[model samples]
Target: MAKRKFKKQIYRYECTMTGEAFKTTREAPNPNDLVSVKAYYELNPDEDDRPEEIKKQLQTEE
Candidate 1:
């Protein structure tokens, strides 16, 4: 007797920004599975500078 092999199928998706593509399985993704993709543009300052920076910004806004 001989055993048989099965072929699995795959699905793919693309990112709107970079036009880069990737693959996925399980047919379709659920609404909850989708993630928000955002870019990080802010940098953390030194610990001492953080408090003063926040205070200055708030005071200027007032």
Candidate 2:
């Protein structure tokens, strides 16, 4: 078998209070929950170039 490389997506999140920048592979569940948003930054992040996370909650509503 041959080796294969998979590209993992990275996301950037911010803490509305501290104004900190963080990176994560998955979207933050309940991004509106500002408390959880701050907690996300407490975790470790990947060391690769990743795209920024976009919040589309406002656009999806009719």
Candidate 3:
């Protein structure tokens, strides 16, 4: 068994918990070190898929 190393590429990412954005090296940081988007989707699989679904709801509400 061996460990996989991630490429160091600078990019902006948001803190899912604080809503604060910043730049970092890793493309996919450790979920334990940060937050997991997959957790939210797994917990609420049926929730609206954001801007698209949310926009549709607003249009229907108009």
Candidate 4:
């Protein structure tokens, strides 16, 4: 099926000065706004749910 878009979704952003990356569903700050994000992208959770990785981690910890 074709991908779908949601009104509010996770967005990944990087710090212009620190290059630190973070994700949030709230509105992302502009590239040069106070938070100083250098770049960002929509992080659709469905595209990378990684169920296998989660299952493996859970098994290892058990």
Which residue ranges in model 3 land beyond 4 Å of their true spot?
1-8, 29-62
| Residue range 1-62, candidate 1, lDDT tens digits | 89888777887665544455666765655533433231111222333344668768756995
2: Cα error in model 3, Å: 35
Q: Which is superior by lDDT, 1 or 3?
A: 3
Q: Model 2, clash count?
A: 0
lDDT of each: 0.50, 0.55, 0.62, 0.56
Q: Per-residue alpha-carbon lDDT of model 2 for 1-62, expressed as tens digits?
A: 99899999997777665666767899888655443342443342443223443223423551
Tens digits of per-residue lDDT, candidate 4, 1-55, equal 9988767777787666557777777765475442432222223434544568875
lDDT of 2: 0.55
Task: Kindly list the per-residue Cα lDDT of model 3 for residues 1-62, writing each as its tens digit.
Answer: 99999777787766566565667666764533554454454467688477778656756995
Top candidate, metric TM-score:
2
Better of 3 and 4 by lDDT: 3
Error of 2 at 17 (Å): 1.1
Candidate 3 achieves a global lDDT of: 0.62
- Among all windows of ten consecutive residues in candidate 3, which has the lowest summed lDDT? 31-40
**Native-referenced Cα lDDT, model 1:** 0.50
Candidate 3, backbone clash total: 0
Give the better candidate number (2 or 4) by lDDT. 4
